[model samples]
Target: MNILKTTALVALMGSIAIPAMAEQRVLKLFTDASDPAPKAAFEQLVKGFEAENPDVKVEVNTFDHEGYKTAIRNFLTADSPDLANWYAGNRMAPFVNAGQFTDVSDVWEENGLKDSLGSALKSMTIDGKQWGVPYTYYQWGIYYNKDVYKKAGVEVPKTWDEFISNCKKFQEMGVDCLTTGTKALWPAAGIFDYLDLRTNGYDFHMKLTSGEIPWTDDRVKAVFAEWKKVLPYTTKNVAAIDWQDAVSNIVQGKAANYVMGNFAVATFKDGGMTNDTLGFMDFPTINPDIPRAEEAPTDTIHIPAGAKNKADAKKFLAYVAKADVQTKMNEELGQLPINKNSSVGDDPYLQAGFKILSTADGGIAQFFDRDAPAQMAKAGMEGFQEFMAYPDHLDAILERLEKVRQRVYKN
Candidate 1:
């Protein structure tokens, strides 16, 4: 009897010592989503991912946004987590090229992301393979004063020529037709991005920014040529003002249109413009055959090349890619989801943006600073600012940029 009791006790102790099933997995996630909103979204993501995958547990490490930018370098090459948060576009090229990020083209393919996340496909791809999954973004387009457009008797334009004609009409009425604040030097980039996207198409624009095309190329000159048409009608003193100040130009009816991101809608409301007075439109089409692309700075998640638990990391990516998951995550995030099947919130601007961006087949761009390297982005925006002030300097600007391109991408 004593021997049988000892055997039972030993069996129970052994069972207790085992602790976990052999199938239990851990996925480590590194993120810069330290802000309240994104943090909550990530928390919800982890919880939901765990619920569906009871066998896997996620451990997340959050970093302050600015610090994470520097920290990602050390971790990606040395002690990589199973997954990491990153930006789309040229911002991700280094990791993709260095093989620090796993090629997630298989995840995208098996999940049908090519159809649902279609808008961001081009931005998320390099060398014909996707590196990560984009979750959220906001649209960038023309936000205009409807009251001013009505007063000027100009209808919303569908083509670049019609828009320029309205610019002439607005100019005649002593109103600035196109207003942007370049004091910060980035907003000028929105105009240039759109001009290049509308004129030369997304591939050419990417090539230009990637230094594959010469700035002195005539195709590049054509982008500036389009800019010249609106220079005489653009708000003057832009070099001295910031983007928010330019918002006042539209608010007070001194300007008819502004090329900006959707985030400016709140600023317009605070400045006393309402949905009735404000209107959003696609940047008028310049090339009928090139397809429409929009500016929507995107945030994404990736599997690290050194990840120990790549299976679960990819499972997490697939979880986030679901339309229902994205809908919930972005609703908390107050941003539009990249999943085409995901539903957006009731905010009219978001609704409009959802329609505008979700349908863009050409691509989504991550804006100038995110799309170009830091040195090149700065030089490019400075050139844009100078060109905004002096359209006549197109040659000098392009030549200077050509030199920088040669130097910046000499590697």
Candidate 2:
């Protein structure tokens, strides 16, 4: 009987100890960094975070870029993760207003992030409170094929007139001057945003996007007029293709230039184009009187208000906000780190982007879709896509978009 009692006690102790051993402090992270490089960088970050905090386990759930856009809305409200990757600016505003995202001001103060994040802090802040921390951002500009430019004997344009002239020259050489994919719609909005920023200035662009200004306003019309000048030079049937397909045209030398964010540089490199063969230039000066503002969309990470592990999520946020962490992750991402002290390395494209954005006197706009409400942004980008395919429908497009703006903003 004594031997049997001892055996039973040992079995009970084993069962109890196993549950204790398996109970780890889990930090659930949902990320949309599906690209190989960014996915790897995130994994590396999680590894480091786990190593530093041995008692905590981080469970990361990654989704494809497009799918995550839809999935985040569902998961954020239903089964909230400890952290999730998202965009700053207006894209984050809804979540902030809904009280879905946690206010990470404490993390910022604890880590002295204001000094580290610099200008990027503006995009992450909503109503005097910081919603999230931006880790990386890249500039949008004209990316051209040097070989194609050489074939056409046209130099990079510096002014608006020069840009138009160069497009004419490329046409004369029997080469398409510009190419873009509007199938996803957002690419067209990017072009519209740049033109608006160049022609009407950043403040006006913000007002227009935020529904403070009507889409049918003359300032908005002027932006479309400027865009019209370049449409003739763009690839035909752009609505049928996506951004990657348009990028292939530039890579294959079917087109001379593309207006895109710096992230597209990776696509170019993968298409077998060398850095020396590709050239990066700022979007030419349209309104030289307007101080140069840039479309520098920042990607951010946030702790959800419904997070099960707020303390651990804050720890991860603080870890990511560090300069060293930003540097490493951006090195993997091949993009500019938001931390002012982080190195951008020897990538010429990144260096140029860094210089342009860091020196932008007029500040930055977080791309059209990011800076505008989702409902309005969707209709606006679709209108842009329609306008690209049928410029004559500009008025109709603007009217339709204006209706969406009114409904969405209740203006």
Candidate 3:
């Protein structure tokens, strides 16, 4: 009888320990940081998280930036990860609407993230509920060739008339006034977003993206009209080349400027262009009456609705939301940390971007594709590219885009 009792006790103890062990099992993470710097930063973040939670193991599955975009839609529904990386704003809207992303507002409230994250919180929130925590974001502006600008004797133009005049002068100096690649489509959308933001203001831009305003409206057409005035100075055959190829025109001194995000700095450096040769400037003012809104697309992380380990996923989100983690990760990736308390380091370009975004009284735009629905973004970018390639067809493009907008938001 004594032997049998002892064996029963041992079995009970084993059963109790198994449950405890299983509680600390793997937390799968799906990420898209194919670039070396961002990938390294992500690895360090995971390493830190693992060290902090010794009981939990993080299984990271990384994909190339482009491949991950398509792969995420499938995985989020079929084999969901405990955590995933994605953009804020309209980019997150589809997943939120589909109920694939967890409502992380509780996490934000519990962790005091609302105060810590500041304005960035607004980008991740939908229907008055927060969806994710933003890790990093960068500013968009006119990155110009300093040498080309100096040779043309043109200072950074701050008004519409001066901007057009400077473009003419640059063309007279035997260089195209601007170089942009619309082959990828989104670059052209960036230009359009800025024009709309500067012309009508942030409220109008947001409404337009949300399908509250028609693409063929007079306000939107006015934006395209302004854009047409600058098109004469942009590179010829823009639709035939990708953004990187277009950057070559600026690097080789064949073009004066490129309106792009801060992420392009690394590519310029790799092409033998340095900060001394390359300069950053805000897009020239179109309407002095309209407040100056900056384009600052934010990237975020979230827990999937089907996450197997909500407890552990919350822990990971909390870990990354801290200012220290944001600072370290963005520093490694050469991007600005979204946390207001985080340091931008001594990099001048980063400092400039941070200053431009943080001080924008007019507020921030999450960029065109990010601020609009996925289907609307797709049709909008195509229309933007078409308008840039053939400005004469502006009315036709707007009408077609209006049809897409109507269909996409048809409730």
Candidate 4:
């Protein structure tokens, strides 16, 4: 009788423990943060979230950055994860419109993100509702050679006219004043983005990219006319060489400035340029009357509409949204955090980026390629490249782009 009682007690304990273990919720996370730094950053977030919610087991599915772009379209419709990583600005619009992503505005309001992540609030929002939480971003500006400026005997330019005038000095010395390789086509769009933002401001620029304004509008012509002023001083072989080749020109002092993202700082350093030699600054102001805006491409995270564990996924979003969490994550990724209260690392370039982006009251713009639809971004950039090579063809290029604009945004 005693042996039978002990056996029954052991069986009862097994049944009790199994149900308790089964109570733990599993949250699926799909991400393109497969690169070492980004992967580690997500791991930090996951670990942090798990620490706070011990009953939630996070299951992560990592994908290559490029491949995930295509994979997400299928997964979001078929087998959606509880959460996924995506880009900010117009890049996320398609998923949002298709009802693949959940509206997380409540999360933003409840967590007080309106104050802490104000800089990124505009980008992460669509139709007056927040869709995701932004975590990391990097600045885009004129990465110039200080040594080249000294060599040209000209001061750093503060206004668009001054920059154009300085280009003449660089031309006189037979050096390219502004060098960017457009073999990949996208680099030319950066120049156009700064030109439009400076000439027209952020709202107008966003309208232009969204196909609300005709590509051949008078304002568009004005932007190209500004481009003409410095055309004589840019790299002659811009259409033939890639961006990396132009980096060599900047490093060799064969070129003066390259309008590029902060990531190029690493390549510039690898090419034997130091912080002293490689100077970073905001893109020279084109219209002093217009408030200054800055370009800072941001990466974000969101909950899928079909998420099975919406509760736990929201908890993850709120966790990553914290200032301390972002500060640590961005530090690991060597990028700037989007949180207003987050502290940047010791890198001078990152620090400068933080200052300029934080102070950009005019607006924060994602890159041209990001703010436009994929097809439109491709066609628009192609037009930008052709315009750089043949300024006389501006009328033709604008008309072609206007047609693409109508077709792309007809919906």
Candidate 5:
């Protein structure tokens, strides 16, 4: 081969290798999201991140939302991703304690994120150190089909008694009054939080989260008793149905309402329902004298300790923390953005959702699951399912919960 020809071939190979080497600096992000809006928003953010940092490529892996908890627990102590999404509250405690996540407090201060994030979400910060950044979050409440209520001649409920009366009214009219997705676990546990919050107030809820109060408390028992009264009104095949099916029951007019997170709005729309046809209400006054406190928690992002691209991950997180990115995320995901300066648009339902969450007299993080460790959350959720199916075995369920709680809190 001639020297000139050989040089040309080597140059061609070098050109290919250069881009491949550039791509090797890619960032890996793993999240548990199947919903279109949030997923699209994440992809959009990745595109924006890559566009701004042309030298760094971003690779994202989205897992089943429910499965992500287990995956993250295992992944955190091993070959963790550059950045990963996780639940806030006691949910993050295990990983934080294990030193599996990078301490982002310094970066959080540098970026002035502490100024915008709500105090309620500070639970994501462990041992006075920030481990994550929250993007979008929505409130948990009762969403009723306006058209169904109109046909049934029932007004929107405000107090606990009113809510029960409304349920009775719906039952009299042969409508399944409440719809739930027990198959997902969290939805069922959400009901428990609402019951507990309205019964014991936010302080006791915190105590419950801290494992200071036993699940066998009278307050806890009262919550179950009240929950049992309305259990008959929930969707008939709740154990077999996931959230989507439960939402469909309401969308198709088989059920009158759903107790769910604000994200359910998008699922409702995907099922051919719209905001005008639906309405949101706070968890009714279980005790009329006390003001209603809403459940408000953030979906958080964290950088694991061993992340290969910590600098790029921090950059990406700061990019996501920007007000513009937050607003875009809210607009795309149909939920409220955590950045105080971020704007949520003029959609009434979205606005109402924002109003409900932001204006709550006080907010408690979701309980049983997020309020407790991941393992305890799992045990409590399963107990809720069993207790719901057989109220007669309440004591046995409580005993089992106590056992698990003892094991979980022993450390």
Candidate 6:
């Protein structure tokens, strides 16, 4: 009888002890911040979070950007992470609909995130339910080598005519005017999107993404025409190389300019150039009639519904939302902080990007990949790569993209 009683007591005590003691939960985080500079910044922030909460452990499992997308889809369907990095806009809609992510509306309100994140970015929150918190954002624009420009004696182009003239000057200097890679399709898609923005303005970009306009719209054709005008200035090998390799062409002085996101700053620095050696500018206006616009979107962090430590994850999310944390993130990573109150430093390259992002006449539109559904964006971008290779097939590319748009958006 005593043995039985003791055994019951022991089991009860074990249960109570386990609840009282420190519990560790592994947080699987999938992110595209794979580069050393951003990785170091994330580690530093995670360390701070770990220090504050001794009982909680965050295990960040990062993958390459493309790999993360595939892995996240697999993981979310089964064995999803406690937290992860995802894009805002239509990108999150499917996951949210499937209940893969937690609805943190209350947490968002309690943390004052609605007030913290700007109105332009508030679209990230869907149907009055907050989905994620954005950490950082960088403007996409033209990055030019000042040395190359100086040698060609050409100023940064502001208008379509000026831009073409500058390209001629660079060609005369025996240099490729634009350094881009269609091997990945994104760089080429970016050029296309920026051209569309410069042609039809931001509203049209949104309408097109939302399926309010067809892929074969004349405005889109006009944008493609502008792209054709500039294509001769692009490296002949753009079809054969990736964005990184194309960027390498610029870094090696084989090309004069690269139109890319500010994230490429790290790659450029790695290739050895200071702010004095580099110049940044908005995509020159293709339509003199249209107003200037901006394409800036936040990189969001969200807690998956299956997170083992929801409370702890929320705490970490809140920690990153602090302005000081944002400043540290931006300063170290050289990207713009999502916190509007935070001031980006005096780097000329960053300043130029900021000028483009801050002073735009319209709301910031997320990148093409983020603004549109991922599957659709993928198909569209691939078609863009094909079009870059054979501009005459623009009609076929648009037809395929229209099919993808119909399938993805169902309109």
**Highest lDDT scorer:** 1
The residue pairs found clashing in candidate 4 are none
Find the candidate with the highest TM-score and give its number.
1
Runs in model 4 deviating more than 4 A are 1-18
Error of 1 at 399 (Å): 1.0
lDDT of each: 0.93, 0.88, 0.88, 0.91, 0.80, 0.78
Consecutive 10-residue window with the lowest summed lDDT within model 6: 114-123
Candidate 4 lDDT tens digits, 1-411:
999999999999999999999999999999998889999999998998899998999999999989999999999999999999998878888899999999999899999998888878777888999999999999999999999899889998888899989898888888899999999998998899999999999878888887899998999999999999888889896999999999999999898989999999989999999988999888888888897888889999999999999988888999999999999999889999888888997788999998888777677789998999889999999999988889999999999999999999999
Per-model clash counts, in order, read 0, 0, 0, 0, 0, 0
Q: Candidate 2 lDDT (Cα, whole model)? A: 0.88
Give one digit per residue, the lDDT tens place, for model 5 in 202-242: 66776776787898888888989998888888777687779
Candidate scoring better on lDDT of 2 and 4: 4
For model 1, how many clashes? 0
Q: 411, model 4: CA deviation in Å? A: 3.1
Candidate 1 per-residue lDDT, tens place, 148-267, comes to 999899999999999999998998889999998999999999999999999998888888888899999999899889988989899987999999999999999999999999889989
What would the C-alpha RMSD of candidate 3 be, to one decimal place?
4.0
Candidates in order: C-alpha RMSD to true structure: 2.1, 4.7, 4.0, 2.2, 5.7, 5.8
Give stretches of model 1 more than 4 Å off. Answer: 1-18, 21-23
Distance from true location, Cα of 54 in model 6, Å = 7.2
**Could you tell me the TM-score of candidate 3?**
0.85
Q: After superposition, how far is residue 394 of candidate 3 from its true place, in Å?
A: 1.7
Q: Poorest 10 consecutive residues of model 2 by lDDT?
A: 118-127
Clashing pairs in 5: none
